[model samples]
Target: MEKQLRKQVTALALYQIIGGILGILLTLWVMFRGELVLTQQVLRFSLFAAALFMFSILCGRMLFRNPPRGLVLSLLHQVLQVVYFTFGEYGFQYVAGLRIGFGFDMVGSWTFKFRVALSSFQFDFGNATGQKFIGINLVALFLIFWIERLLEQGKR
Candidate 1:
C-alpha cells in the first residue's frame, strides 16, 4: 500500500475498533439502562450480540495486520452488520407501496452495525416506530471499500 493509503487504513482500523468497543458498551448500557426487566430470552440474545461485537473488534484488529486475510475479515465484519427483519409494528398506507428506507439509527445504541435497506432515503436519530428504521452503517462500508480501492490503486 502507498503511504497515504497506509495512513487511511490505519485510521479506518482505529475507527472500526473503536466502533466495536462503543457498540459493545452501548449495547450493555441499553440492556440494563431502563427499568424494564430483561427476560431470559432477551438476555440470551443480548449475550449473543455481545459476542458478535467482540468478534467485530477482532476483525478490526486484523485490519492492522494488513494481510489479504485481513481484508477478507474486514469485509466480512462489515457484512455481518447487515440485518434483515420487519418492524411489523404498523402498516404503511400513505406510501401505498413497500417503502424501504436507507438510514442511520442510533449508531449501535440498541443494535450493532446493520446494513439493511431497500428504496427510500432517510436519516433517523430519533425513536420512530412503524416507518423509521435501523439501516446500514454506511460509514463502515464506505471506509472499507475506500481502503480496497486505494489498495488497488497502489497495486497499479
Candidate 2:
C-alpha cells in the first residue's frame, strides 16, 4: 500500500529473481561442463549468492519501513554491491561442489552457514565477488530497465 513498502517489495522480488537465475545458471553450467568434486571454492560462491539474496530481502524490509527514496535506493545499491562481492568469493565453490555430486540442497545449506559465520563475526567488506556482481548487475539492470522503458513508451 505505502510507497516505501511497495518499493521494498519490488526490491525483494528483483533480488529473488536474480538469485534464482544465478542458481539455474550454475546448475546448468555444472551439468554441461561436468567435473569431479564440488570444491570449497564452489561451495563458497554459492553460499555467498544465497546470502546476498537474503540480504537484499532484509535491505528491502528496512527500506520499506523507512522513507526518503534516495536513501532507500542508496541502501539497496550498497547492499547489492556487497552481495556481488560475496557471490564471487563463493561462486566457484558452488560450481565445484556440483561437479562433485553434491545436490543444490547441500550446497545451498553450506552457503547459508557461511553467511551465518560472516554475520556472527561482523566482518562485512567488499570482495572480488562483490566487484564482479556490481559490474554485471549494473549492465544487466540497465538492459532490463531499457527494455521496460521501451515497452512502456510503446504503450504510450
Q: Which candidate gets the maximum TM-score versus the true structure?
A: 1
Please give each candidate's TM-score.
0.61, 0.32
Listed per model in order, the count of residue pairs whose N, CA or C atoms clash below 3 Å is: 1, 22
Candidate with maximal lDDT: 1
lDDT against the true structure, per candidate, is: 0.52, 0.37
lDDT per residue for candidate 2 within 67-130, as digits (tens), equals 2442344344343333222343443222101111111223234321222111110123344434
User: Candidate 1 residues 1-156, lDDT tens each?
Assistant: 667767766765675667667667766777788964797756765676666667666766886775455666766665544332334242111110122324433433554443332221121222255442344345445655875775576567
| Candidate 1 collision pairs | 115-136
TM-score of 2: 0.32
The C-alpha local distance difference test score for the whole of candidate 2 amounts to: 0.37
